[model samples]
Target: MSVDRDTVLKIARLSRIKLEDERVEPLMGELNNILAWVEQLDGVDTTDVAPMTSAVETSLAWREDQVSDGECAEDVLKNAPVSEYGFFAVPKVIE
Candidate 1:
């Protein structure tokens, strides 16, 4: 799959990037090279290979879910610039 100048320009426009007319040719060539490499990878056999997230298999260590000490409403509202009814207060938005 070869990328032409028009395709490059269209891609640049879609990506919201402004590319100069002279830069289009080089970008097209680079994109085409990448596509050719992907095409080459299509010839490889991977029927026996298993999909993996990482090269080594490992399990994530996890801690037991247990609740401990928690802050009271007064403690939480102590640092607020404006608080009422044990909650942070902000300016009213609607009339």
Candidate 2:
């Protein structure tokens, strides 16, 4: 999984990054080192490890699902500059 100079240049081009020719060699080495570290992670044994969504173990509080008007339409309409028929009113833009 070592990164070559051409591969580095191709990646830079695809990403639309303006990488200089002189910087390509150094970037290639850095990318290769990162890939080597990731490859090392494959050797770890995880047969007993359970996949988890979060590191902390916790349960969400359950609530009954009920549908109702929030009853705050009047409160919200107060902020509008002009409201008509229980809704916000704006100048018609379409001709």
Candidate 3:
């Protein structure tokens, strides 16, 4: 399939692209080449190919989901500019 100057202009307008008048012909040729390659791909047969979700075949490595001992609240809050009641305090944004 060949792309014309008018088709290139229409595509540029649809894509919200600003194209110079001189650049239109070359852009149309490139677009036509891309379309022709796609047309060539359409002739290939994929009757026995299985659909793939991922390129690599592997299982997710997981760890035990259990709560463990954590750092002391005072130790964490020690670096805060402002802290109160085991929490960091900041300026209120809304009334």
| 10 residues in a row with least lDDT, candidate 2 | 62-71
lDDT of 2 by residue, 1-95 (tens): 77898899899999999997899999988999889988987898989988788878888888779865687889999989999999999999898
Against the hidden reference, what TM-scores do the models get? 0.47, 0.47, 0.46
lDDT of each: 0.87, 0.89, 0.89
State model 1's lDDT.
0.87
Q: Please list the residue runs of candidate 3 whose C-alpha ends up more than 4 Å from where it truly belongs after superposition.
A: 46-95
Q: How would you encode candidate 3's per-residue C-alpha lDDT over 41-69 as one tens digit per residue?
A: 66778799887978899888997898676
Ranking by lDDT: 2, 3, 1
Residue pair clashes in candidate 2: none
- Candidate 3 has what TM-score? 0.46
In model 1, what lDDT does residue 87 have?
76
Error of 3 at 34 (Å): 1.9
Total clashing pairs in model 2? 0
CA deviation > 4 Å runs, candidate 1: 13-16, 61-95
